[model samples]
Target: MYKFASTASIAAPSAQLTLSGSGVFIFQIGSALGTSLNSQIVLVNGALPQCVFWLIGSSAVLGSGCKFQGILMASASIGFMDGASLVGAAYAQNAAVTLINSVITVPPACNL
Candidate 1:
C-alpha cells in the first residue's frame, strides 16, 4: 500500500498502488521519454477526489470503487474494473480500452 498526494508524481517499479483515504493522486506510470515498457495498477478505497495517470509507453489497470477527476493517457491500454468511476477521460493510443461494469462520465477523445 502506498500513499501519495495530489500534487506529487509517482514513478515506481511496483505494479499496484493503493489509496486509503480521501484525496487526490497523480501517477506517472511509465517513462515520459517513452523509454520503458511496464504495466501499472491502482486501487482506490474512499473518495479519490482527483487521480491522474500518465502512461508514455505502458498500460494502466484501475481497481474498483474509485472516483477520478483527471485524465488517463496510455500508449497501450486502460482498463477499469467493476464499480469504478472516472469523471475525466482516457486516451489509449495504439491500443484499446476495457471497461467492465465501470462508469466513465466523460468519454475519451483520442487524437487518432
Candidate 2:
C-alpha cells in the first residue's frame, strides 16, 4: 500500500490515513529486502491500532530513540535499536524479534 526508499524523520499530516498521535504515515520499501528505519518519530494517526508496516519476505528495523505507533508485521525479522519504542505491537512471523533498550507496548484493546 505504501512505499518508500528511505526516510530521515516523519512528522507530517495525511488526508487519507489518520493516525492517533498527530497524522497518518505509511513508509514502505520495495519488495526486495527489508529496510532499516533510522527515524526518531514514526507516528500513525488512527483511533485504533492498525497494521502500519507489513513486510513480506523482508525484515524491519527501528533505529535508536525511535518512537513509533501502530503494528509492525514482518515475515523475516524485526529489530529495535537502542531506546526505540513502539506503542502498538510487532510480529516477526517466520523469524525473530531483537530489542536492545527498545520497548514495545501493546495498545489498548480496540472495541470496534
Candidate 3:
C-alpha cells in the first residue's frame, strides 16, 4: 500500500512495479527543479516482478517483503528491512542505504 502526494520521478530501470492488497504506487519523476518533491512509494506484493533499479533524488522506501532485481540509486538515502531483498547493485550517490540483514547482489552489468 503506497500513496504519493508530492511530485517525483518513478523509473524502474529494468523491471516493473506491481502493487498488492488494493494499493496504488505513485511515482512522479523528472519534475521541475524545485517545484515538486522527489519522492516515491512502493507497495509490497509476492506476485510482483522484481525491481531492476530505482533512480531517486531525495528518498525511497520499500516494503518489508518486497524484492528488487537490480540496482538502487538514491541521492539522499534508502531504507528497507524485514526480509527485503535486492538482487543487484546499490548506489547511494550522496547518501547511504539502511538495511537490516537483507539480501544484496551486485550484477556484472552494474559495472558498466
Candidate lDDT scores, in order, read: 0.52, 0.58, 0.47
Query: TM-score for all predictions?
Result: 0.50, 0.61, 0.52
CA deviation > 4 Å runs, candidate 2: 1-38, 41-56
The better candidate by lDDT, 2 or 3, is 2
What range of 10 consecutive residues in model 2 has the weakest lDDT sum? 8-17
lDDT of 2: 0.58
List residue ranges in candidate 1 displaced over 4 A. 1-27, 31-53, 107-112
For residues 1-112, what per-residue lDDT tens digits would candidate 2 score against the true structure? 5675543224332112244543333556543222234443333444445545444346777666666666676667888877878888888888898999888888765444
Error of 3 at 25 (Å): 18
Candidate number that wins on TM-score, 1 or 3: 3
Q: Tens digits of per-residue lDDT for model 1 on 33-100?
A: 11111223344565342344343455666555444445777777777766656667878897888888
- In model 3, the runs with Cα more than 4 Å from the true position are 1-53, 110-112
Query: Which number leads on TM-score?
Result: 2
lDDT, residue 46, model 1: 53
